[model samples]
Target: MTKPLIIGVSGASGLIYAVHALKYLLAADYTIELVASRATYMVWQAEENIRMPAEPDQQELFWRDKAGVKTSGILNCHRWGDAGDNIASGSFRTLGMVIIPCSMSTVGKIAAGLSSDLLERAADVQIKEGKPLVVVPRETPFSLIHLRNLTTLAEAGVKIVPAIPAWYHHPKTIEDLVDFVVARALDTLDIDCIPLERWKSS
Candidate 1:
C-alpha cells in the first residue's frame, strides 16, 4: 500500500496554497491525511468568504468540491482537536507531512516539540521519524523572534518554504502566482505532480 502524506493547514493568509496543493496531489493519486486548525477556518472565511464546515464528514465533502476530486485519490479529514489521530504516531507510516500556510505559532510549537493538538503532534511525529516535513509559512516582515523560530525549524531538517512567489515565472494572474508558490512547496518534498514554469536564465 502506498503511504499517505499528512497535510496540516494552519491559520495563515494563503489558504489557496493548500487548495492548489490538494488539486495536484489528488490528480497524482497521492492519498492525504488532512487536518485544519480552528483558526484556519477563521482565516478561510476572512480571505475567501467561505465557511469551512467544522464537522468531519461535511469538511471532507467541502474539500472534495474545493479540490475537484470526485474519485481520484483518498483524503482523510481529521478533526482539529482529535489528538488520537493515526498520523500522530510514527507507527502510522506516512510519506511525510506538509503544513501549507503554517502559522508562526504552529512553527514555534513544532520547533519546540510541543504537540498541543493533532496537527502539531503529527508534525512532531514526522520530525522524530526523520521523514520529510515541509512547512509553507505565510508571514510578512518576520521579526527576530519569528526568524529564530523559523531557523530553529530549519536546523531540525524542516523544509521552510515561505509563501513567496517568483516573478521570474512571469505570472499574469493571481492563480499563476499562487501556483508558483504551491509548486515550490511541493518541490521540497520532491513531488512534481503540478506543473509550473521553471526559471531559465536569459
Candidate 2:
C-alpha cells in the first residue's frame, strides 16, 4: 500500500505555493491528504479574488482543476475543523506532513503544542510520531517572536523549508520561481515531487 503524505495549508499569504505543491505531488501520482484552514479560504479570496469551495469534497475537485492533473494521484480533503480525523492521530500512518506557505500563527501554535484545529493537530501528530514535518514559511521581516517560534520547531526536528526561490537557476517565469520553492519543500520530505536540479557553480 502506498503511504499518503499529509499536506497542510494554513492562512499564509503565498497560496500559490500550496497550489504548485499540489500540482507537482498530484502529477507524480502520490496520494495526498490535504487540510486547509478556514483562514486559507479567506486568504484565497483576498489574494486570488476567487472564493474557494467551503466543502471538502468540492475543494478536492477545485484542486484537481487547478492542477490540470492527468495522473492517478488520490487526494483526500479534510475539513479544517475536523479534529477527529485520522490524520490527527499518530496511528494513521502517513509518510509525514508538509505545511506549505506556513503561517506564523500556525508555526507558533504547533511549536507550543497548542492545536486549535485540524491543521495544527495533524502537525502535532507528526512531531510526536517522530515523522518528518516540513514547513515552508513565507512571511518576511520576521520579528523576534516569529523567529523564536520557528526556532522552537526547528529544534524539535521540524524542517524549516523557506519559500525563497533560487536565482542561480535563472528562473524567467513566475511558475519557475514557484516550482523551485515547491521542489525544496517536497525534497525535505524525500518526496522529490518537483525534483529541481542541483546547483553547479561555474
TM-score of each: 0.96, 0.97
Backbone clash total, candidate 1: 0
Tens digit per residue, CA lDDT, model 1, 36-154: 99899899899989999988888888988888887788889999899997888889998899999899999999988999989999999998989999999888889898999999989
Off by over 4 Å in 2: none
Error of 1 at 79 (Å): 0.5
Q: What is the lDDT of candidate 2?
A: 0.90
CA RMSD of all predictions: 1.1, 1.1
The models' CA-based lDDT, in order, is: 0.90, 0.90
Clashing pairs in 1: none
